[model samples]
Target: MNFNFLSPVSDSVLAHNELLSAQVLGRKLHIHSKQNGIPDLDGVSIAILGVLENRNDVNYIGEEFELNEIRKSFYALFPGSWNTIIADLGDINKGESVEDTYFALKETISVLVKKNIIPVILGGTQDLTYANYRAYDTLMPMVNLVNVDCKFDLGDSQKPIKNNSFVGKIILEEPYNLFNYATIGYQTYFNSQEEIDLMNKLYFEAYRLGQVSKDITIVEPVLRDANIVSVDLSSVKGAEVSLKQKYSPNGIDGKEICAIARYAGISNKVSSFGIYEYNPSKDDELTSMLVAQMIWYFVEGVNCRVKDDDFSNEDYYQKFITLVDEQELIFYKSLKTGRWWIEIPFLSEVNNKLKRHTLLPCMHQDYIDACNSNVPERWYKAFQKNCL
Candidate 1:
């Protein structure tokens, strides 16, 4: 019930040489600045907790990655109105139990909710989602949980909290009927026929990866009704969540994943959000960059959806037609970093006139780059000139 962060983490510990520094998009509230928490940002508060350890990946020195650089990565990804506050869980050993982590997260979430700010949990593992939900349980008797993961994560084995058993623990511990939970993007390799049978028996709503690819729009209704969203970065194919568990060479590309994140963020019912399993140790430069991009798109989705006016286009009511006529407007299929980009003319004026705020242009660039792969630059230039 009472809120406290694991005491004032010693200045030296919090301020290590590797802790990189980058300006966040919104107001920055260092926990040391105000113990009572920022009173003003009750509606939308942001917190980034680096739970950067696991039973399997124990050798990893969680803090080696510069915090400021990581922050900068986020800055480059999600550009606007981010009330950023960050903390690190350090290397939580097997002795350092999930319950304690849950306590810390609960206290933090309590404070943010009291102040009306949205709380985001960056994960150490998928198991953290259970801790997040446990924290949620302390506040409300019932809250919907949407798990966007590549696996069903429900196995009969009573193994230590590892890669695939997180959802199983939740379902068994907390009766499925009591909570509205849906599993999306479940791949074949992750689940067994028995597991699938159990899920069907339990009447759990599920969408396989093929189904997701068929039409991502159906995910809209699932998210729209959920109270909390747990997004496993592994669910995304190209994500750099784990070196050992990496799904690279094949996975959902960056852009669609961003769109999914955006939808979850804008889900009005979504009070809490989480992105898990970011094993930076295995990640390359591009991996963090992609994570950053996804974060940006999520924020943009929230901003766009929550804003009073629609800004899909500059004019509120224009001749609504797909303008990509003869000239193919080059845009990437997925917004990856270092992709080609064409300037969109009249963008500033349109944004200003429409009263729309676009966050993290880097993400937009990723989108532009991906789509433009097929489309020509000259067409883009012409489109830009016409729009201007």
Candidate 2:
């Protein structure tokens, strides 16, 4: 538990916390403060951490930011009927270099993950996700990342990593822990044709902004299978956030983004969650409150989680088999939660990246599509990736 890199929460926020009702989250959380120091994480289920580094932002102009506003908004909200213990471990201030900040964040996340505690990261820039992804290098054999962003952020990995280009580094970097990467609510105009083709060529998943807005439920299965979930506040619609935080006129609305966060939290496989690219401004109250509610929904979803993925017992799930284009598709439905899963046939002969991901979380629509002799796009991509 070497959290030496972490700075305690500010005294002003603590003063604000003192005024909050005892029933609110601020009073209930195990907060790391100046007077109290770091709280013991013995029974903590989730830890809130903030990163104050933003040099990697392509638009960086030597500006500093803080998470106090977001913290204030979060603290004011009343908690739902929940049993999960949460800790506010405070912020990691910017180091001498951006890489130094990344090192510190990587170390902090690595320690938190190894303890089986989910780190709800409030980030300075989306590129911090690269550090978060790297934290999983030694912890797991393979990783699946789901980014809720408007752009793919697949910038040239050969150059310096920016907030928009970190994904490229994740894909090309060594240790090669990233097995799958998916983008939800991606706007096509923001991405180049080459990046779009590259995503398809790599057999990765990308759900369009329009498609996701039309049906947010489609993302449940994607999030369910993911190990790391990163959200860019810029993905939220311009009208839904503060002027400084707005990126696109068209994007996921506040409720939709929060729903996606809840889905990420409810997923049994999702180990680490991050909300990045927050640009605080003078009138960022709306944005701060939205971020706060998103966290609240995520914590709420975590409390509602059930062990419905265990397929060992016959009573827990029901299985179905169908044929499409001579390809046998097997589906499993959880009796406990009614969630669906489609099995990817393990290729014993090939060196597979998805050795542990044989059962792919799917939707009931996928089963219907399979029955109608159509292959689900997710299954096809995952199956192809497994073969490669």
Candidate number with greatest TM-score: 2
Q: How well is each residue in 340-379 modelled by candidate 1, as lDDT tens digits?
A: 2232333554422212222111123334444445433333
Give the Å shift of residue 160 in candidate 1.
Answer: 4.1
In order of appearance, the predictions have TM-scores of: 0.63, 0.99
- In model 2, residue pairs whose N, Cα or C atoms come closer than 3 Å (at least 3 residues apart or on different chains), thus clashing, are none
Give candidate 2 misplaced runs (Cα > 4 Å): none
* TM-score, structure 1 vs. true: 0.63
Residue range 1-388, candidate 2, lDDT tens digits:
6888999999999999898888899999999988889999999999999999999989999999999999999999999999999999999999999999999999999999888899999999999999999999889989999999999999999999999999999999998888899999999999999999999999999999989989999999999999999999999999999979988789999899999999998999888899999999999899999999999999998998989998999989999999999999999999999999999988888888755548999999999999999999999999888887
- The CA lDDT at 76 in model 1 is 38
lDDT of each: 0.54, 0.94
Once fitted onto the true fold, the runs of candidate 1 whose alpha carbons sit more than 4 angstroms away are 1-44, 56-69, 77-95, 157-160, 174-177, 239-245, 306-388
